[model samples]
Target: MLARHHDPIAAIATAPGRGAVGIVRVSGHGLAPFVQALLGRALRPREAHYLPFPDAQGQPIDRGLALFFPAPHSYTGEDVLELQAHGGPVVLQLLLARCLEAAQGTAGAAGTAASVLPHLRLAAPGEFTERAFLNGKIDLAQAEAIADLIDASTAAAARSAGRSLSGAFSEEIHGLRDALVHLRMLVEATLDFPEEEIDFLRKADARGQLSKLQHMLATVMQRAQQGALLREGIKAVIAGQPNAGKSSLLNALAGAELAIVTPIAGTTRDKVQQTIQIEGVPLHVIDTAGLRDSSDEVEKIGIARAWEEIAAADAVLFLHDLTRQNQPDYVAADAAIAHTLAERLPPGVPVIDVWNKTDAAPGVQPGSAPGHEAVRLSARTGEGLDTLRHLLLEAAGWQPAAEGLYIARARHTEALRAVDAHLMEAAAQLESSGPALDLLAEELRLAQNALGAITGEFGADDLLGVIFSSFCIGK
Candidate 1:
């Protein structure tokens, strides 16, 4: 809990640089004295007063509107003050310096100094929200949502953050936690006096509660995954033999010559990546060197790097040249890649055969392969690009109504997955060996803790620091 100190914390609560107005914010019990010193007069809470802000020597710094918000109802659950002034960087800096000077000194009578005063310090990144959390103004989940709102990249991301800030995510977690507690209470009551013969653990109602808990957690995990995908886009890698039109496909998809197209083989001995948005979904398109056997040290090194890239990619596009007849070298190249990636690629990674250069070849239909469903198109002419786009979207499970998606990090997705795993384990324990109630209870508790980490109900110290410090100042 935050200490109810008389001291105040101050910061420029608006973004830096030029704007219509810049806001210098202060919050705590000592706001009254701080305001009087800076404004050259006392101010009534919840009222906006126009006044000339003064420097340390009583010289006028700037004329601005001052606002006061009394304690227990303000953002930090403390008395808050806001000075709205010209937004120029230089002017704001001078204004901020004067405010700090005013906060540090004795209490003032009109424009003169008095004996007693309150101490104030600058707010750190996310510190104001942290204080809000400490003071019960907002919960851990809502506090994190505030930071997410500031960093949202898309409209859907912003909306999801807003929902979480409004306690949508927290409400779900709390509901689950409440159910767990009820079940734990029932189990503990039975285990406390086994001789009662009531058999409380064998009741149908207990099983129903366990089942419902599992189902609710599963639904939340799925939604969290979607939100994470919307927040952090997938990494798609393009890999194939040399001269398979990989570079051309990259250029076509990216709408620019991001990579150099050439007829010569082994031209690209490095990986090139371009970020493109398809129907609002960001795709990190990585073009890797053509996978092949090479004696040249540089080419071999690039080929090695290409394998690493393919292994890390969310999906891989295996490009093939349809115009050229199947040759032994091409067959061997494809075979080598297939054997190398037998265990490396994640399950369900879309490995589509991309048939490029269809315009140069005659009588070949520009479509998928025979019984293989390959995407046939001319990368140079932009044919079948739309088909490829649709395939990518389908592979990602993207839908038209994806506005419900929330932005989540990989750590968040992993945590949710771990929660799901534990919940399932707990469900299994509920029915085994006369109901291992203690282990089952522990598993449910662990599951709740994992979910809690996503919304900051429970988090490692380093993680809390990392999450908040990443925020922009004045946020």
Candidate 2:
């Protein structure tokens, strides 16, 4: 995978289907010969020339506009060729095959002797953007933003991804890196001038510099947190005993009849999920089967799946029917479900007790679930649902949509957190009386490395493979 980038690559650059126009793109070193051989002439750089893209017999496959970009001035930092043709799968496929055939010296007619390009092949998914990163045209964060922009689910998400692609996120990472590098220089210099170390440290205000960096990192982390929330929304699972109005709550929240609403206890035997956006943040809500001991084999499987979803959930809504709050048996079953939730849920997962059917029992005062706040609502009438929405957003730790927010991945936030940890350790070493300068220097060094990983300065090959492989082809 690491060595694949050295080869010239070709692929259809447009979306699959019938459209007004489609494009076949090629990129690599010395693509001039390939272009001259396929198009029957050497075209000027960066100019669109109307030409006939020919097959082996000098047969015109299609007449289209061809644009050429030379090395160091293209999207992938290599020579690039784009053929704009009529939008049809067959035309694009034939054009791509002809390009490959000419490059690989497999064309039967063999009209041009100088047209063969050595090591030309098809591009892998994201290989174009990966080359851009590898050749210093963009950093890892910006490369990732290309994918985020293509996959953005909402307008706000698309805008945020655009910001990231333009280097807003990488700029912050680079800022941290620069600051960290400065501190490391100061710490390392102390060893070179040991006799003046005490006076130098006092004059330079190392402690003050460290404090400022920590503050800057704190602010950056908060922004990244918001960005990550926008990029990867929270997963919420709605669960409870039989007939607690779980499906009704789903319908009310989604403002649609997504899940079937019936008095029957086990109407939903599998998980039903819908993604709803609140203030540009996506919330994936899931409705699970009614929790109960049953003789039916299917219900048992559903109950088991519910537990699995709960275990992996970011938040859970434990639904309780307001009318049944007074029944001893109903209350006991709710308690048993609560006990299982506590035992099975991972630590830090929020559970919001939702009391449903408020219209059915208007006089019943809903008690909050123990150890957590409760939201009382009638899913059928849409009462108190707005309150529930706000609480779920709070559980997700999302703030009001802010200005200049950039989309970030889970890895970006995790890397920032790791940098923060190292900075904290360095701060401790700086504060200790008769501090060990070596320890302080090591911490700062590690902190910079962690920060560098965000922009590919310190990333591993496998990490690159995992990141770029997720991108759409021809990007």
Candidate 3:
């Protein structure tokens, strides 16, 4: 896989389909000659030139702007060429094909493109960004952020991804790494002089330094956890008995009539989904079919699917009808749902009691179930929704947004956790009655390695492949 990184790659850099403009990009070592060969004229470095990209027969494939960036200064630390042309698919394809033909020593009407760059081929998905990472132009974190920024579901997510791309997250990792290195050096120096090992670490304030490092890691972990929430929002499933205002709550939360709401029971025969953001944290709220024992075959299927969704939910909003509190049958059905919730809900998925239609039953004190948050709201009047939104965010484990936050992934949080554990081990070793300098040193080393993995300072080729393979072609 590493050997494949050396191959020159070309790709259409724009999103698929028609647009006002599209881009065809190529990156490789010593591409200046290739640029001249393909364009029939040498391009000024880092300058855009108006030109017509010619084919093997020298006919214009598309007239557009071509820009060149020389090696060690480009995105991949290699020579790069970009052609901005009309966004039509066929026009970009012809230009790309011409570049390939020219790479194979095919001569156009004006000049020969032979041997300028050999073995030119189509870029694999994320190959372009992967090269940038491998070449040290951007670290692994920043490379991942490129995709994150593109796939961001909210403005906050996009901003955080941009911060990460600008190396905000990498900078934090580097800071932790530098501190760890200093502490490692101090411990190793102490190990070298066994006669005064304890006293040496003692005078150097190594414990104090380690304490500071742990504190720093904690801050990063908290920020990364919140950022991961932005990247990966939780699934929130709304469920209850028929006419319990399940669809009404969903519509109210989504601020649109997404789910069909009626006085009739089983109006929603399927799930209605909407992605709503609370403080820039996305929640994929799904209103599943009401749960009940239905004789109709179709209603039974819907109810079964509702259980499926309930089992899979990150948190279940078991909405209860406030007006039906006095009805004995309604109470039993609600209890049945609570039992199924306990039986089927994945462990750790919170079950919140949402008392709907509070406007009709003002000041109704619905009995709160022992392990679930109770919220009273009138979905029709849009009251108590703010409280529900806050509770949902709380249930998702999202903290208040921190300043200078950067988007992070699940792997990042896991890596940080590993670093924290290693640091804790090192601290314990330091605090031991007869601390083994070697164990302390080893723990610190592992912690640094974990930190290095976050920014590509330490990682395997397979890890690199998995990270970059997730990106779209042409970065």
Local distance difference test, candidate 3 = 0.89
In what order do the candidates fall by TM-score, top score first?
2, 3, 1
Question: Tell me, what's the RMSD of every candidate?
Answer: 3.5, 1.8, 2.2
So what's the TM-score on candidate 1? Answer: 0.87
**On residues 1-475, what C-alpha lDDT tens digit does candidate 2 reach at each position?**
3577789999898889999899999999999888877887989999999988888888799999999999999999999999999999999999998988888655455345554787888889899999999999999999999998888877878899999999999998888888878878888999888788767877889988999999999988998998888888889899999899999888888999999988888998999999988888888899999999999999999999999999999899999998988899999999899999989988888999998888899888867766676888899899999999999888878888478999999998999899899999988887887778888899998888888889999999999999988977888
The per-model lDDT (C-alpha) reads 0.75, 0.89, 0.89
Tell me how far the alpha carbon of residue 376 in candidate 3 is from the true structure, in angstroms, after superposition: 1.3
- In candidate 2, position 378 carries an lDDT of 92
Which tens-of-lDDT digit does each residue in 1-475 have in candidate 1? 3353345677888887799889888777756766666776778878899888777666667788988888888888878888898888887888777767665563444344542244666777876776677677887667777877786666666787788788877777778778777877776777677764146666537778888887887776677767666666668788888999999999999999999888999988999898877666677889988887788999999888998999887777878877664577776667676656656787777676778888887466534333234687889899999898777777766775654555556776797788778878877876665666667778877877887786667877677677667666555
Give lDDT for model 1: 0.75
Q: Lowest summed lDDT over 10 consecutive residues: which window, candidate 2? A: 106-115
Residue-level lDDT of model 3, residues 1-475, one tens digit each, is 4677888999999998999899999998878778878888998888889989888777788899999999888888888999999999999988888778878777658558457678788999899888888888999999999999999999989999999999999999999999999999999998779999999888999999999999999999999998999999879999999988888888898999898878888888988899989899999999999888889899999988888888889899999988889999999989988987898877888988999988999967888889899888989999999999999999988876467889999999999999999999999999998999999999999999999999998879889878878878878
Model 2: colliding residue pairs: none
- Comparing 1 and 3 on TM-score, the stronger one: 3
lDDT of model 1, residue 5: 33
